[model samples]
Target: MRKNLAGVRNRLLQVVALYAPGGDSTRVRLHRLRGVEIGEDTWIGFDTLIEPSYPHRVVIGRRVAVGMRVLILAHFAHHGRNRESSEGTMDDRVSVRIEDDAFIGPGVMIMPNVTIGAGAVVAAGSVVTRSVAPLTMVQGNPAKPIARCGIPLGLDTPIKEFYRRLTPIEPPAE
Candidate 1:
């Protein structure tokens, strides 16, 4: 009964957070009460969905910006084929941490066990499957590194510096 009541309360808070004003501190507070560890001055945009089942697994660092419609999932099914049946798929839970000063763009989906490094910028609509490096800019499905903003570690070229650098697709010359 206690667990069920907590779940209901958490759901209500989520609804309130969705409807609450963007600048309202109450919205942030509600999420905190729901067990999401959001740091000071972090801006969680409208419709942002943090892991509801494991809210405590999500840790948002100071000044991080989670854009509208962003989905941070702390749990996923190991087996994709049989999603409905509990026996078919095993549910795995892992913590997700958005480091300080990181920027998660709108509609982004961050999978479990991912850590958005400090000052990293995730482009809109990105699907992050793994951890991102600090001070890097990532985009596209699976979230490949596009550029580095801070001082390079030791790589010769720009592309070489990335953790998983992908060749940019160029447009056909007209």
Candidate 2:
């Protein structure tokens, strides 16, 4: 009965968080209350769907920005057709960790067990399949590294300097 109640409460909060009246603070507060480990000053944009199954497994670090329509999933939710498996949490499920100062662009989908490194940039509409390295910028369906960022794109970092310091990665020989 307790478990069921918790699940229901989580669902309610999820819905509220998605369309909450306030900005980042309101969203962050709701998500944290629902079990997501959101750090200081992180921004969760409109309509972002975080882990519904295991919200505790999704950890967002300091100053991270999750764009609108982004989906960050932590578990598969359905391991198989087995009733027992569906009823209980998967023991082997891994957490999806987004480290400090990362920027996840709009429409990005991050899968479970992947660590988005600190200061990494995931471009708009990308589907992150694997772990991104620190200070790296990635884009595309499978999210490949596009450039190495010299500084994290934060309020403190100068816009011109950030752009100037980017080192684009040469495409693989085809």
Candidate 3:
């Protein structure tokens, strides 16, 4: 009763916070989300988009950080193509998942049927066409692994530590 009401209220607040202009505190934007479970304390940045379009489901693990303008698509509804096709069945939609503690940078794009392992880092503007392994750091257009996150890149410090110290600089508003 009371707990149910509170849960509903909280979800409504989250939706409003995500869509309201100038409301920057909210972390996630969900559209037609179904069967996907998002973990606790995850921070989904502004302009991030997520959609679940398949029966297999899309799952998001805890403590994940998704950067602004990142696009996570679980499926492609090929309704237009299906209508034109002579075949009775159409190959359309797939599921996607992101494991715990994963960090996806801004402008990153994740396609369907892929799972991002825990502690993985996807670089900015990278297009993730395949599954990323755990604790790995991937970059580039096709999102290849440049290095492991916690492994030393030569300076006796891990690349993950370097990324942790980085502060993204915001541009001046027009």
Candidate 4:
């Protein structure tokens, strides 16, 4: 009982944090939600929206960074057999899972039934229609593989270490 209550409280807090006044401009709007998990230390930028039509349709992992103007949709409008009578309704619904440490760039669109693998980087302005491999970089309209992470180029350094090496140069004593 306590766990259930905690879960509800967490969900409510998330909704408030995301949709509250003066909070994030990017908000998650849904018709129905169930078992949707957003991990810790994730940053969702402005103008982003996530709408899940069905229950348990969206799951975002930890340390995931979503850029501005990103859209994550979990339902689509499908037309019936009769084209004339079918006006296309939101019937086909699927789940979308963004794994841990994933970086989704600005203006990116993630469709339903897609899993963004762990540590994957989706470039800015890309439309992702399929699953991305782990630790890979994908770009372009359809989001193709551009590069792989953990490649040996002597440039592999922890983010903290890289930042720690930076030094501010002082002006010459004038």
In lDDT terms, how accurate is model 2? Answer: 0.89
Per-candidate alpha-carbon RMSD to the true structure: 8.0, 3.2, 10.4, 12.1
lDDT tens digits, residue span 59-162, model 2: 89999988998999887666552434443545334479999999899999998889999999999999998999999999999999999999888646788998
lDDT of 4 by residue, 36-64 (tens): 55675566766566652333567787777
- By TM-score, the candidates rank as 2, 1, 3, 4
Which TM-score value belongs to model 2?
0.90
* Index of the highest-TM-score prediction: 2
Least well predicted 10-residue stretch by lDDT in candidate 3? 23-32
lDDT value, residue 34 of candidate 1: 86
Q: What is the lDDT of residue 18 in candidate 4?
A: 44
Clashes of each: 0, 0, 1, 0
Worst 10 residues of 4 by lDDT: 23-32
How displaced is residue 96 in candidate 3, in Å? 1.0
Ranked by TM-score, the better of candidates 2 and 4 is 2
Query: What TM-score, over all chains together, does every model reach?
Result: 0.75, 0.90, 0.62, 0.61
Q: Rank the candidates by lDDT, best first.
A: 2, 1, 3, 4
Candidate 3 ranges with C-alpha deviation above 4 Å: 1-35, 52-56, 79-94, 151-174
